[model samples]
Target: MKQRSEQSQGTVYGFLAYLLWGAFPLYFAALKPATAFEVLCHRILWTLVVCLIALAATKQLRFLRDLARDPRRLGTMAVAGVLIAINWVVYIFAVVTGHTVEAALGYFLNPLVTVALGVIVLREKLRPLQWVAVGVGVIACVYLAIDYGRPPLISITLALTFAAYGLMKKRIGGSANALQSLAAESAVLAPVAVVILAVITARGETTFTTQGVGHTLLLLSTGIATAVPLLLFAAAASRVPLVTIGLLQFITPVLQLLCGVLVLGEHMNLARWIGFAIVWVALAILTVDSLQATTRARRLARAAQGAAC
Candidate 1:
């Protein structure tokens, strides 16, 4: 009963996290005239400020000292920071340039990329169904490329960078909590952010001061927007099974796709629809395989307990 309650709470947290993430296109769209690079710099610096404040409030500032002592882990996080910064700037560019649908496609493709990375980098073997899912994903990408008359570079880049970032986080293991991890990544990027902001300010091209109070506040709120969903995701991860988390990951892309078509008025031709459908089919197959494997593991564990008893 306690486990079920925790799972329920986790599901709620997961939904809220994805909900916020899915609505990111709208928030980013509202930050117009700021330029993606400027927005990224503000996001990085403000996120560091927010994380530092949260760490201090929670009495978790010591993690930073411990993390600094571990050069290897700090280096891994630095790489992760660069990867995430790429992902963030690309995403902002996609939104500002009205390619949010393509951005949505990238997130939809992320799971497949992660799985492929596992096989290539971790030397893990894929089950037959998993292989089929990945193969179908490749087909979808090919179709998309043919339809677009070129590769979907935005989608591919987002998937690759985010998947690589996840791999780096996995390498870091559980040595740092979510807040600490985000704080460290923010710290790593903060110097570059400072430089960017300095250059922009020196040129008098910055939108932060001239953009009106509402816009300024929106820019300031970027930090909270970045951190809240991540914190919720961390909470959910602690309480829910990995399979549940995996399934819930679809919510963000699905919502982004909706926002693109309905709110952003992005055009989608029949070919694009067909391509997205193929990707969805692949995701469905992957989801089913994951569910079946999880069930089998649980059954085996139960049977072993019964035998021992």
Candidate 2:
């Protein structure tokens, strides 16, 4: 009963995280901001503000002090900060430009790339099934590339940049919290946003309208919408295991796929369906291998304890 309850709680957290992220496109579209760049600026600027609020509420100021003292960790965070910002910009661009279909593809391809990067960068060994999973996923992407007659740059960029951000975060030691890190990163970029706003206003390139209060308020709320899900995700991450989180990541892509087809009215072609099927099969294989691997690790640890006595 206790086990079931724990699992249920984890499920709830995972679901909340996925649901928020999955529904993000609708919120972004509702904002109807000037351009993706403007939306990106608000996302960064407001995300920073949200982070600072969380940091204050949590009293993680001590962590901030330590971060200020440690240059190495701070430097790594700088790289992570930039990559995540780039990811934010690209994602907003996808939503704003009505190419959410491409953004969906990017997220769908993210997990496979992260797994492949683990093998290449961390020198992790993949099980047979995992290797096959990786192979199938790669083949699917290759098919897309060939069929499209060009590389899937948006998908690849989002995947690789996010994966790199993950890696950089992993390497940073100590209490450099995600929310705090994001806030700091956004703070770093805030000046550029201010300057751009100034330049655009000077050249009459700014999109804000004094005549419509509703539209202006909607644009401003993009920050809250962008920041809230992330805060929820951070809260959920502590309560959930990595595998659960990994599985939940699929929800965003699945929703995007639905949104692309139904809302955006993207056509479904045979090649696209076949490619998606191959990717799904690969992910299934990987998920099974991961479950087995986790079980094996637990058993081995118990056996080692028994031997120790």
- Can you tell me which runs of candidate 2 are displaced by over 4 Å? 1-7, 62-66, 305-309
Q: After superposition, how far is residue 16 of candidate 2 from its true place, in Å?
A: 1.0
Query: Candidate 2, residue 225: CA error in Å?
Result: 2.2
Tens-digit lDDT track of model 1 for 1-309: 999999999999999999999999999999999999999999999999999999999999999899899999889999999999999999999999999999999999999999999999999999999999999999999999999999999999999999999999999888888999999999999999999999999999999999899999999999999999999999999999999899999999999999999999999999999999999999999999999999999999999999999
Summarize candidate 2's per-residue lDDT along 1-309 as a digit string, tens digits: 876676677677778778888877777776665777776776667676776777888887566667768887777777887898788778878877787777888888787788889999999887898888889988988988886678778888888988888888778734566677776667667788777767767887566674278767766776677667766677667766777887888998899878877886777788877877877888888888888888899899999999999
> Which candidate has the top score in TM-score?
1
Evaluate all candidate structures by whole-model CA lDDT and list the values in order: 0.96, 0.77
Backbone clash pairs for candidate 2 read none
